[model samples]
Target: MKFEFADRVNRLPPYLFAEIEKQIKEKKAQGVDLISLSIGDPDLPPPPFVVEALKEEVANVKNHNYSFSQGEPDFRQAVAEWYKKRFNVDIAQDQVVALLGSKEGIANAARAFVNPGDRVLVPDPAYPVYANGSTILCDGEAVPMPLLEENGFKPDFDAIKAKKAKMMFLNYPNNPTSATVDKKFLKEAVEFARDNNIILCYDNAYSEVSYDGYKAPSILEVDGAMDVAIEFSSLSKTFNITGDRIAFAVGNKQLVGGLTKIKSQVDSGPPVYTQKVAVKALAAYKSAEPPEFLKKNNQILSERRDTLVECLGDVGFPCEKPKATFYVWVNCKGDSMEFAAKLLSVGVAVTPGVGFGKHGEGYARITFTQPKERIIEASERIRKLFK
Candidate 1:
């Protein structure tokens, strides 16, 4: 017998990373030495201290049981403290909710607040979860806010056509685009959301991944943000702990409580052992400076980013070196999908800009997640094909 998927599931565009994974597998099966620069999964391991902490936490029998739906108290308090120390933003423990990952929290937050007919302002060429995993799954209409190059890959707030969008998602140290924004821009975004009576969802997953002394800010750092915005941040990218499924949503108690309620019905919070480890991870933030491990990790990624950008420029696909994130957004000047496929033929796999959204059509995103030597090798492969 055949089965029909629910409308929500059916509405999702083909998951971009899933399709990329399949292509990578097919290429490997053909005995091609493929170098995948498609997905954002980090090749680095979590700091040794994090690993050691996890090992100790798992041995405690209490950690094996179910945690509070919101989160363990210790973990929530750690989140609150970290916000103060890192962003100079004050938040209470009650305003924090642990997440399996920011991805799950984003989708569940949509479910908590968005009504079937509500409109959500989403940036084009964004991480697909904003539109696909979140808004569309809630039967909400996703209004595109194009992130154009002329505007530094940020959405032009005045151009938004939606008169009454219920929500808006924004990311900095952005995925796919690698765009960075200042606190001033975030303040404007907060004002825009407040003026429009829209709920703002800021994804700060790449907050710790920066280079050239650039630091990312929390939306809550803006004065009025606490009233209108909720931010999702992850240890996944920051601490190279993606597999641990640790992240949180902070700011706006109502928003955090609503998401926590949804999570209570659907699943338990993140694993107790992981939260315990994450607490230690967050506690490492003593002052404004990042932990030594994170600094070292960013250094490796910075070197790789430089090598890849230089190689791409040499091959005639000129792109700017982003000050944050491990991605380089290249202007391929043609059909991004075809350009990506052409590179794949040369054993270098990149994410086609079209997979992100229509505006991503003429671009391609290259990640420097691999070792520096591997990045150089991939660049040589692209140069051989393009130059």
Candidate 2:
């Protein structure tokens, strides 16, 4: 019997990371030693407290059962308290929902709100999941808003005001671009959402990963944000527990409930043990200052960012030293994919700009998640290759 894939699945865009992984495997098979600065997975371990908390929770038989669909009560309260402490914003337990990861929450938020043919506004050169998860997977229309260079890779909100959209996705400490938004911009975003009656999905996953004393602002810090926006945050990037899959969606009770309804139909909820671990992690964070291990990770990432920027500059690839996130966006000038292939062949892997979106064309992104030594080595290889 012949089986046809669903139309939605048929039209799915190729995942960029998969292609990068394929090339990496091919090179490894041929015995080429590759330094991968392409993927953004954090190289640090979760703090000792996080591990101990998980271990302690695993011993409790109660934590082995199915958790609440919204979130465990303790976990939700922890999130609320953490938000109050970190961002000086008031969030209620009722407005919080547990997620497998911020990625899952992002995709599900689109699924919950988007109807077929409804328009979704998205920034180009963004995390693919934002546009793809909202528009393609949900059978919605994608209105591509270019992230202009002059605007520092932020979409022109004024130009988009006339466009009718059911949802709009924004990220800061932005991925691919590595730009962070100020509170004024966030206040403007909240105003835009309120005026347009659009649901604002703010991805704040990299909020904890800033550099050079730069602090990323939470959208909830803006006035009226809770009335118009939902913020997604993750311990994956924050505490280096990417594999642990613990995150939460906070704000707008209705949207939180909508996502909860969709989640109930799809699966039970986040793993009980993981939710327990998350409760501990959030409590530990809000209770005091960041641990030395977490601070050291930021310091190391900052040094790596500086090294890559300087090295790339010496090789004629001028990059603005990113203030946040682990990625450094570079202009490759011509045929980003071709240049990426050339770099890959030389055992240095980087993401092609075009792989992100049309706006990302002629640019490439490198991750600072690699060790400083490896990043320096990749930069040296790039310098030698280009020279």
lDDT of 2 by residue, 209-310 (tens): 887778788898888999989999999998899998889999999999999998888876788889888877776664335556667889989899899999
Clashing residue pairs in all predictions, respectively, total 0, 0
lDDT of 2: 0.88
lDDT of 1: 0.93
Per-candidate RMSD vs. true structure?
Answer: 0.8, 1.3
- On TM-score, the candidate that comes out on top is 1
| Candidate closest to the true structure, highest lDDT | 1
- What digit string (tens of lDDT, one per residue) describes model 1 on residues 1-387? 999999889988888888999999999999999999988989999889998999999999989999999999999999999998999998999999999999999999999999998999998989999999899999999988888999999998878865869999999989889999998899889999999999999999999999989999999999999999999999999888888899999999999999999999998899999999999999888887898988999999999998998988888877898999889999999999899999999999999999989889899999888887789899888878876
Error of 2 at 60 (Å): 2.0
